[model samples]
Target: MHDFCFAIPYGLILMTGGVLGYAKKGSTASLAGGLGTGFLLLLAGFLSLKAFKKGRNSYLAMILETGKPVFGYRGMVYAQSS
Candidate 1:
């Protein structure tokens, strides 16, 4: 139910897709976009998990999980709009 739970899996999926795209079609864009976004999400997920262990929330993870709005301000709104 936590953000990290989804973010981690999503990140892994993105990363795998990126690698597959590059391997199957040599698409640099896909590789870059997928890998970059995936890495950010994965890092954010880890941060969230760490915070959860300490009984805290990770705004950074929440922001990234929601499409990573500017400075995380209005992230939920942006996510909804998108």
Candidate 2:
């Protein structure tokens, strides 16, 4: 699911390129630019996901160490007295 979320933007970009290629009567430059944009979008999304995961793990660790509950759809951990 996460991977699909990441792929959607790039897929849209590539689709746009294909459309432009047909529209421009098969211009190679337009196709190439579209591919490039798609690749860059994928790369950016990958990096963002990596950063977010790293930050989330660190935050979870902090909360656990402080004995605080981490609440979400995930299971809750009740805080323990020091």
The best candidate in terms of TM-score: 1
TM-score of 2: 0.44
* Candidate 2: pairs in clash: none
TM-score of 1: 0.78
Best by lDDT: 1
Clashing pairs in model 1, backbone N/Cα/C closer than 3 A: none
**CA error at residue 34 for candidate 2, angstroms:** 0.3
lDDT of 2 by residue, 1-82 (tens): 5543645475576759766886878877667656655554555455556656776333332332233112311222222422
RMSD of candidate 2 to true structure, Å: 17.2
lDDT of 1 at 21: 97
lDDT of 1 at 7: 84
- Candidate 2 lDDT score at position 46: 59
**Residue 20 accuracy (lDDT) in model 2:** 82
lDDT (tens digit, per residue) of candidate 1 on 1-82 = 8888988898899889999999999999789867888888899999999999999998887777776435335744676799
